[model samples]
Target: MASISSLGVGSGLDAESIVTKLMAVEKLPLTRLTTRTAGYNAKISAYGAISSALATLKTAANAFYSTKTNLLTSTVSDATVASATSGTSASSGTYALEISQLAKAHSLSSRVAGASETMGTGSLAISNGSNSFSVTIDSTNNTLAGIRDAINASSTNTSVRANILTDTSGARLVLTSKETGASNTISIAVTDNDGNNTDAYNVLSNTNPGLSQLSFTAGGNNLTQVQAAQNAQVKLDNVDLSFSSNTVVDAIPGVTLKLTKENVGTPATVTIARDSTGIKKVADDFVKAYNDLHSTIVKNTAANPSTTLSTSTDAASTASALTGDSTARSIDRQMREALRTVPSGVTGALTQLADAGISIDSSGVMSVDATKFQKAVDTNFSGLQSMMDGYGKAVNTLVTTLTDTNGVISARTTGLKDSIKLLDNQKEMLNNRLTSIEKRYRARFSSLDTMISGMQTTSTFLTQQIAKM
Candidate 1:
């Protein structure tokens, strides 16, 4: 074989150019395969967009049909006094609420005289009526600030929070219960074992005294109970109820009541009703999502202007990559049919989307007639829900068929991938064949160049020999 670098050197013929031209012709089939691979890849991407749009539509439809979408609103005449939250289990009703007192946690402040004083080098034990935890008071945590930090850092000290308050006199230790219930009343006791120093131990003991030391009259310590640990007191419709916490759940079936202030003897009316605003928003979202999906389908399936036979040519030449595709056509057709047909599970006057103020037009896009929808919601709320639920099921089914693992989109994607792989194999085979052809062409052209050089040499020899004759 002749070296590629010197193939045309012998005959001065442009053999490299000739071989390149031949190889270009030979690779025609590979070019076609490459083009086909690109087309398949583009189709896969188009399907991805289609599937994504359908997924959005499916999510909206599912939300519209959910039973939990039946929203309820709680209205308190005076939110300043109290507020409430309502769920699906809550029933529409009015209740007269009179809050006698708000639940409070126990708070105690030590005497202001020795406010900056540190006490006790032993363990401070706290009891929450039933449970007890101890905070160690060594030299490292012997000061008022250290003891406060030790109490806060103790894993078992979950029932109470120790704080230090500073004023004109000095800083005093303040202790408060973590819970509001009466059973969570904080009991403080101190025991000193640190022989190094008794100053911290003595100070803590003087401030807290003991669990039975409820009065601040002993040791000049002003241990005053700022607030008592008490349960919330409320009279609902003149019926009394008590709770350990201000936020009460199941106080009225599915309603949660939060007492902000005490309004004794004065009644605040609380009304629970169906939340029309929330329900309407769900419907509006459904319409918007459907329109978005419809728009995607229209844009992708619009025919080129040259191919259009109808009067409509809003989307002219430069048709989408998905134009004239059967899958695109199927999606458009099925979506329209699903939106148009009344749900099989729904009955009565509010059976169709249009009955609930949602209408689909020739463009296959949905719009909400807010006035009519509100009327339908007010007139036959349950019936409207049933219609939406049933339609949502149908839309979900369509999306599942198209986007599922064994669905059309997956199958099409797999097919495109296989085609690309096959094209790759064809490209490899063509490349191998071109390699052999290039080798043969270089050798044959080298022989021709050698023959032409020899022929010119022989002609020059014959002319010299004839001139000598």
Candidate 2:
């Protein structure tokens, strides 16, 4: 192997040329990661724009879903209002509730067959002839835990589960048959229980919720038996809550309350409607979301260069188009009105957003008084509902206008994506051009090294001739 210097080349300049060529390869990935590699990057900017637009559209869609324009108007028309319950606002001691309907339930019990008792251990084997596990009893094995462990160790995917049955005497072990499809059962065939099958084993029953009533003392805590229902029972810190059938479900946050006609006379008319607090919260949320979106758009698109909001060329263009463009502007206007509109049927304090005690600051943000807004809803709920009427329809229309494939936001985003794609294509071509330029430079250096090597050989031969002279 000849080094560049050994090839009649005085300096390792050709080696430096290889180093420079390698540097170009290292820059390829770096260029991809940064905008400094600008002109050569394919439509990354457009891709970024489209991705952002998609994200915004999805976010807006989610907001639309969270919003409910329909009236929180669940009416408890009929009910056996044994004792009606109504929610109370912390504002006025008006927590007095009238149940619109009584709660209903079904008594639960099973018609399972009784069992025969069986004792200690046997070579319990699943269907396979040689596959089996043996149980050893040292008298202490009579306990439930011991039986459970023995069955589990039996090697079958099936477990030896036990249910404790209650009778006048005490708890008795009810073992289950592990196989599936009804025929699986524990069969005690008088193998060796002091000769009598009756004294030795009792076959367990699988009829009920396997072991519906099992209580054990683990660490001295006595677990009680109670019927557990699939749905959580509604309660406020454990105060059993009853709800009327006509009650609005979301009126309670993280809880359920019953409706019945208790306080309201004759027909037990409990207003199974949205709780004032919950409704106000929703209204407040809508106001905040609308305002937040408005502010974000304004900041992003604002003509002022001093603002900290993103005003990059693409972002600025989008902002301008959104603010001035009729579709974006129109939809934005509708959303604004939707948040401000009041339910026609509502009355009492603060009819409009202003009356609900909500106000927008100069920066286009909403602020509201928690106490005052709640009080207005509690006393005159219908009036408040009246104000919120048209907003739902308006929002649906706005969402369609902004997020639909042909909507304003969608159109702008699509255009941005296309433009970015084109820009990126141009960038890729430029990069290939740069690679060609660098490669040509390396080839020129290779030719120069060859020329230098030839000259060095000729000079060495001349020097030898002079020495001979």
Best by lDDT: 1
- On residues 1-469, what C-alpha lDDT tens digit does candidate 1 reach at each position? 3343576776788888998898899888777777667667777887877788888988888888774435678889989888998865788899999999889998887655343344446776677756688887765766667777887888977788889988776776788988897777776665656554323223333653222222232233336687888999999889999999999897887899989988987799999888889888888888788787777777777766665534433332245667777877787788878877887878888877888878888767688999998898788877877888888888888888888999877887898789899889989998899889888887788778888877877998999999999
The per-model lDDT (C-alpha) reads 0.76, 0.44
Model 2: CA > 4 A from native: 1-11, 14-274, 298-352, 378-380
Candidate 2 has an lDDT of 0.44
Q: Output the TM-score of candidate 2.
A: 0.44
- Residue 91, model 2: lDDT of 17
lDDT of 2 by residue, 252-366 (tens): 4322244433443433222435555556556666665666566655543345445333544344333332333344445446556655666444455545667767676666666
